[model samples]
Target: MQKRQSAKLQREKGRARRRRRRIRNVGAISRSEVEASTVADPLCLNNGIYLLVRSYNYINILYSTISLLFSVFLFNRPSLSLFILKGKNYFCIVLAAAMSPWRIMMGMIKEKSIRIEKARHVFEAKEEYFIQNGAMLLEKQITCNQGRDTEPIKIFSAKEIQQATNNYDPNLILGSDIATVYKGMLDEREVAIKVKGPTIYCSTELMVDFFLQQVTIKQLISHKNVVRLYGCCLETKIPMLVLEFIRNGTLSDHLHGQRNKIPCQISWLDRVRIATETSYALCHHPTEMFLRHNNLVDYFVLKMRENCILQIVDDVVLSQGSNEDIQAFAELALRCLNNKGDERPSMREVTIELRRILQLVRSRDSKLSNEIGLALT
Candidate 1:
């Protein structure tokens, strides 16, 4: 009786063990199924691709529509009589557009390039400034351009800059663009400081590069018309770009003097001189094609002569230069106002031209003096 009872108890125990094992396996399988079917964040990958494709597709469609319209206008499609005479509906538009004005397309391309550069500076800073390089660099030096640096800069305390500007006085405002520019004296030497928005999440390396670019461009640019950049201040957790004090302010301001002047602040000769100087500065890029001072200046002088110097002068003339010095100065102004960047004269050329105008002014003054002396005798 005892042996029979033992065997029955063992069988019951085995049955319970099997039941527990089965439950454990079922749980493991359920967990695996849940893990396998997990959903991902769809917005980043799929959405980014969709946006890029949509943008490119829209651009293509716009260009195609422009092309079609251009063709229709070129064949003078308004006269259906001509279309019927040609005996082809579509070919006329194509042929007319084939001979379409190229200048429009060139202008579009130039505008596009300008916008692309501007957009890169604006949007990339917000969206992708933190994207780190995932690959190894083979080159020793890489191009870096951040507007300021991580290293401590010689920063002016808010108190000091404020005091320099008479306690953040509005009257001390040097320039008013997106941010207010102030004229302040740091280290007893005056500086024009542009206080803009706070430092963003941009790389320090890029700031260093921007500093270098500002320094290099300022140093290499020999033209008198171009503004010089001093070192920038970035230690305040805010990036402050400092530049050389262009006492006269922008050429635009000088050419078109501000509210204080009831009359034009500059004479026609001065206007001409400024324009010529700016043009010359742009054409200073020395290459085999431009040869530093020759080809572009030549073209600039030629076209300017035809147009005359009257176009660029701002309405207000603050002061008149010697009246006798006006015409030659005007002609020089025309040279500087040439439309093509490459065709514009360099600052050097402008300086030379101004000197010649001065000579002309002196000669006229001398002639007038001679007349006075002879009349007195």
Candidate 2:
């Protein structure tokens, strides 16, 4: 009788505890949803409207006065109010056009533009970095929090990045070069972060240059076959480059037994696409920064090729295609492999050639749209 009573009491206690826990969970979820909903409400958009109106008023007043003044001198008669009104209207039209959805940046204000300024890479010890401005500067170098001008547009606090990367856990690794990389998630977007400490041979400038070179290449070229460059992080002097995390493992690993299962066979056409894309990047960007998959190439190539040699072909995203297309791609790859950079064709030439090949391949496949270019070639 005593044992039965004891067992019954324990069961009742457990049931009561579970009920209370369920109630607590419901309350927590309700609170979170309320907070999220409040933050996302469109009612807060009045501030943006207020700023936009202020901007319009300022611009109209300045431009209208100038126009009125010009009309008085040029026309030899001053109908100042009418002419000023016309000028204001024109200014308003231009402003509206600029703010239109079709406009690229939606006439974002200085504050908004700065906020939209994406983080390419954030480095620690950013004191060492300086933006080496070449010809194509979409953005100028910005001062880091240290009040020192470092290369890269801006620097990020290390603590902030640490929070984003979850303290750089091993699982965050996307790919490793000389350092481990982490796939970071911030503002709900995926970012590949490569973190490195100050190295003996590499100064901060050199490191920033390395990532900038990568960005430079991406800026010059874009294709489905190449891994895309998002931006880099130089918040710290010891920087991390954030890139598009290719969820698929490297071609070497997939083709070789390095990843898992039997070494997968890469079709000749797919190899051709990869080759073409690699050549395209080189011809367009032209970098001296040669990368070696030192830790990975040989094992991967053995499974993919009988000769077991992997060199420049290792860092590529292989995709499916045809034999003739493959041949043209191979030629381009050979040009990329050319020891002399000067020997490589200009990007303009390479693009023209690729288009021709694509056209030829399209004709063969019947997938080529006649509208793509009757006059284009």
Candidate 3:
């Protein structure tokens, strides 16, 4: 009876163990299924929705592109001419709406500001040029020399000069070489405008200095034979000189003619007179400034020294002048052209010598005229 009871007890224990094992297996399967469902459900839904949204966006972009292109194509076609015309009023309305009074005023203000800025820069540049060209020096000279009887140096504006020169018309050009001379009218008087030629060889500083020095020297000189300096224009890069205009051509033009041929024959007496007047003008100023040599003068001096001056003498002069007077004149000219500055005679001495030569020529002419008259009678 004890053995049977033990066997039954063992079988009951085995059944209990098997039932616990089955329960554990079922719980594990249920937990795994629940976790998988929870993870996969939202992932699948999200993937599907993402694909739908992406497809919608692509379709929308494609539609917009096609619509824009189609609209442009349609608008460019001839069939749309009437539609465009009909839309003009709407376009005008839209334009008018966009261009409000405030916007218009702002644009105008911007344009005006630009113009003002440009004008200011131009004014500043002109002022700088004025100062650089020795305006202060000129003013001081004028102030120091001021008197009721004295003629002051006038400062000319660029505009006034332009108008006087007819805007530098080509027809108004009197001559052009190193500098251009223009015929103009200023202050109701006929004037000659002298402007430096545009050249790349010179620098601005050198030109400015030259102009200042020229103005200073010329203003101090007052002689009938010398070209009168009326004023100067400093508005340009190089200053412009306003001079008294002579109706007849320049002395050079009169002596040598325009192209090459002698324009007119000036009698020997007139030539001597002109020379005397010129010498007087030179002597009126300091002689030191007039001692500079030029190629023409050097050639003349060489010929004079060689005693071959007759060859270069003008035909009119040779025909009309006395040999004695010519010799004396030549000697005087040689004295004036001496190589040593200190050895050169003073301008006063030159003037006196010229006057003596003139008297000799005049007395000889008078004696000749008397002889001719007596012989004719």
TM-scores across all candidates?
A: 0.36, 0.39, 0.61
Clashes of each: 14, 23, 0
TM-score for candidate 2, residues paired by index: 0.39
Which lDDT tens digits does candidate 2 get at residues 341-370? 577566667766776676665565454345
Candidate 3: residue pairs that collide: none
Candidate 2 local distance difference test against the native? 0.49
Worst 10 residues of 2 by lDDT: 45-54
Weakest lDDT window of 10 consecutive positions for candidate 1: 79-88
**What alpha-carbon RMSD in Å does predicted model 1 have with respect to the real structure?**
29.2
Model 2, residue 372: C-alpha shift (Å): 25
Candidate 3 per-residue lDDT, tens place, 205-304, comes to 6766666666776776787767888999887778888989988777677777755676655677777888887777667565554545686788888888
Model 2 ranges with Cα > 4 A deviation: 1-155, 188-190, 197-204, 212-235, 242-328, 367-377
Clashes of 3: 0
Candidates in order have lDDT scores of 0.48, 0.49, 0.67
Report the number of backbone clashes for model 2: 23
